[model samples]
Target: MKIAFVINQTHKEKAGFTTTLLAYSALQRGHSVYYIGLADFVYLDHDKIAAHARIIRQIGNIADTQQLIDALKSTSKERVFMDDFDVLWLRFDPVLDMINRPWAAAMGLQFAQLAQKLGVRVLNDPRALVDAENKLYLENFPEEIRPRTIVTRSYDDVKQFFEEQHHEIILKPLKGSGGKNVFLVNKQESKNLKQIVEVICRDGYLIAQEYLPKAQYGDIRFFLLNGKPLIRNGKYASVHRVQSTGEIRSNIHQGAKAQKAVISPEMLQMVEKVAEKLIQDGMYFVGLDIIDDKIMEINVFSPGALLQASELNGEDYAAAIIEDLEKSNGKNKTE
Candidate 1:
């Protein structure tokens, strides 16, 4: 089967990340792959989607890592239609370069939907993704599984929220990732809260919620594939991400350490309730941020954790993810 990954940019990726591993695994399975970037996709007449893709033939017997990457990058670019592939994985992290081209941020979801309409299987179905666009989507979870929250741009709205909570609050842009512009507001920083709100809210909505006191330890990030735990050798694809000592954000991109984690019952419950909906909505792969068992965020587009989770569990999680993709796509195409 031919598999193509629609990404933001190839040069932006680093070694030991989930996206790279998945693409490599696909090649190891003898499947052809095309790595397409944001500008690669072309919308033709009648909504046909296409891109110039680098067709990676196979992973040679080279043991050295860097050379293997060189071989992967050496493929010639070819214009491949989205309908030609059995699966089109939207592995690009839009938030990474969203500020650069705001319009291109939605291209993955938009084209994924188009490709699906043409009978190609896409991860995290585009329809579900459109609904999961912002942090406010977290509120759709069971109330018991989410932290007390308020979404508003009104100054009075934020003040009343802080007054009611009367504790440290975690404020961030409603539509954001990698913990960009996230803030921890307390009595000492109360005055700055308004400024923070002014900045983030100007671009979009703001999220001001009761900070989970337990976040100091770290947050547990769990990966749910096809609405089930992708556990192998008794290890689930998950990890505890500890923030940089005094920092409130635990996103690994912001200097967080990944460690083994215990999947609490609350975490499992939340994943189960949300995963089915995600899969039903065409989300094959996803990640959920759990702090004190409250669902903080649900990453539908390019939900990455395979690398860190695989590192902690002593198994390559990308292999598991790609295997699942093959199985699901095979089943769908056969049916």
Candidate 2:
């Protein structure tokens, strides 16, 4: 099977990214793999969508992730039609390019939606992704699992929410990621409330969430493939992220250390609660940021840390994911 991973940028993709893991795993399974950057997509005549993509074939038995990345970087890109691929995985993070290449991520999804219409299996459903362009998508799910949240662009609105919540809130950009603009505010330190709201709302709306007390202990990044936990040999493909001292964000890129996650029954039940809607919406893969019992965030586009999960759990999670993809592809072709 030919699988193409659409990422933010070819040069920016590290060897350790989940995209690289999946791409390398697919290649190891004797499948042709391709890497397409967000800005490389091209729409040709006859409604045919193509990309100036880096296509990798089994060349001299690539051994490691670095070897796979080196092989791709050494090769030049060619224009490959989107319909020629069996799977089109949109792995680009929208917020990564929200400032610099603001138009790039949206264009990538627009192309994915086109590829889906052309019968190429696109993961996470591009159509649903458009609706999930920001944090507000969480509101579509049962309110029970989500934190007390309010989206606003006005400083006064934020102040009201802060007071209502007794002056403890987690302030962040509604359209941001990687903990770039996240801040924690309390009643005593209200001096920065106006400034924080102003800074966060500069780009878009501000998400003022009632501060979850468990956040200090960090959060668990639990991955769901096809709306269920991605597991192998009774080991879940999930990781517990513990934040470094003096940090509120537990993102790996933000210096958080990854460890094994203890998946509680309550967490599984929470997954079950949202699984149906996710499946119906064609969300084939997602990462739920579970802090205690409440979900902090839902990452549908470009969820990472799979390698960490495998390393911590001692399971070949990438192989399992590839196997599932193959099975789903075969099932789809027959139906």
Candidate 3:
């Protein structure tokens, strides 16, 4: 099967990224792989979607991640139609390009939605992604599984939420990621609360969430493929990300350390409820940010960290994922 991963940028993608891991894993299984940057897509007449993508041909002994990275780095890109591939995996981070490339992520999804119309399997359903344009989508889920939250652009509204939450809240951009522009504010002592809200709201809405005390210990990054916990040999495809001391964000890029995760019954229950709806909505691969029993975020577009999860569990989780994709050809293909 031919699979193409839509990424933020070709040069920005590192060897350790989950996109690289999944792409490499697909290649190792002798499947044709392609990497298309967000800006590389082309829409043709007659309702066709195409792109200039870097194709990963099975080069000599491409056995590991590093070798695969080297192979990708050395290869050049070529024009390819989405109809030629079995899967158009949306692995690009929408928030990463929200500033400079504000139009990039949206355009990529627009093309993916077009591709889906052409019978291409667009993972995590591009149409559903349009509804999940930002963090507010979590509000659509079961209220019990999410933290008390409010979205606002006004400073007074944010201040009200802060005070209502007993003077403690986590503030961030509704559309932001990678732990960027996230701030934990205590109303009594926070001098920059106004400025934080101003900065976050400059781009879009500001999300004020009740700061979970468990956040100090970090959150778990749980991977769900096809609306279920991705597991191999009884080990879940998940990782516990412990934040650096004094940090509130548990994102790995923000210096959080990854460790083996414990899948609690509460977590499973929450996942089951969320997955049932997600599967119906076409969210094929997802990552849930779990802090205590509340879900901090639902990562549908470019949900990652499967590599860390695989390593922490000592399991070949990627292999299982690629194999599943192979065996379920028309299962996930969008009409």
> Which is the leading candidate under lDDT?
2
Number of the predicted model whose TM-score against the real structure is largest = 2
**lDDT, residue 61, model 1:** 70
**What's the distance in Å from true for residue 295, model 3?**
0.6
TM-score of 3: 0.95
Residue-level lDDT tens digits of model 2 in 1-335: 88899988877878899988988878777888899989898988656889999988763578889888888887899999989989898888899888888999889998998898899999879999999989888889999999999999989999999999988999999988889989999977699899888889889898989998889999999999889999899998899999999999999999999989999998999889889989998888889999988888889988889989999999988888888998978833111
Overall local distance difference test of candidate 1:
0.77
Better of 2 and 3 by lDDT: 2
1-335: candidate 3 lDDT, tens digit per residue: 78999988887887788888888777767777899999898878757678999987664578777878777777898999888878999988888898898999889888998888889988979888988879999999999999999998899998888888999999988988889989999955578888888888888998989999889988999988899999899988999999998888888988999998888888898888898889988988889999999999999988778889988889988888888897788433221
> Across residues 45-84, which tens digit of lDDT does each residue of candidate 1 receive?
5556788887776666734335545665766678888888
Which ten residues in a row are the worst by lDDT in model 2? 326-335
Kindly report which residue stretches of model 2 are placed more than 4 angstroms away from their true locations once superposed. Answer: 331-335
Off by over 4 Å in 3: 330-335
Candidate 1: segments with Cα more than 4 A from true spot? 61-69, 72-74, 331-335
Report every candidate's CA lDDT.
0.77, 0.89, 0.86
